[model samples]
Target: MAIITVMVFILIGIFELTPLIKKGDIKGFAINLALLLCSCTVLTLKSLQISVPSPLKPIENLIKAIIE
Candidate 1:
């Protein structure tokens, strides 16, 4: 599963990121790569049966704190 996830992301990078890189859009390439890597890591971990904290947890906590 992890391998599959990585393969998919690699394909995405090759196809999607190639154009951005060729265009010399460093900022766009960096941002896209960062987001892709983050998502890829999370997906890979999940595939490996690792527990990943929900992103909404912090926002929920912040809302509770504000209400209090």
Candidate 2:
């Protein structure tokens, strides 16, 4: 199931990247690829039941401390 999900993401990424590659948009393609990879990694991890630590926790804590 996780494999299937990752494969689907790969297909979606390929579909999305085709236009940028054809148009010679290097910067846009790079940014899009980076974002797509990051999202796919997160989704794959989640599908595999992996627990990812959130970066926002410290910020939230800081905000709470300031409020108090």
Q: Who wins the lDDT comparison?
A: 1
Residue 58 Cα positional deviation in candidate 1, in Å, after optimal superposition? 1.7
lDDT of 2 by residue, 5-48 (tens): 88997898789888999999989999998998888888788889
Candidate 1 per-residue lDDT, tens place, 1-68, comes to 99999999999999999999899999999999999999999999999999999999999999999999
Residue 26 shift from truth in candidate 1, angstroms: 1.1
Q: lDDT for model 1, please.
A: 0.98
Error of 1 at 57 (Å): 0.9
> What's the lDDT for all of these models?
0.98, 0.88
What TM-score goes with each of the models? 0.89, 0.86
**Off by more than 4 A, model 2:** none
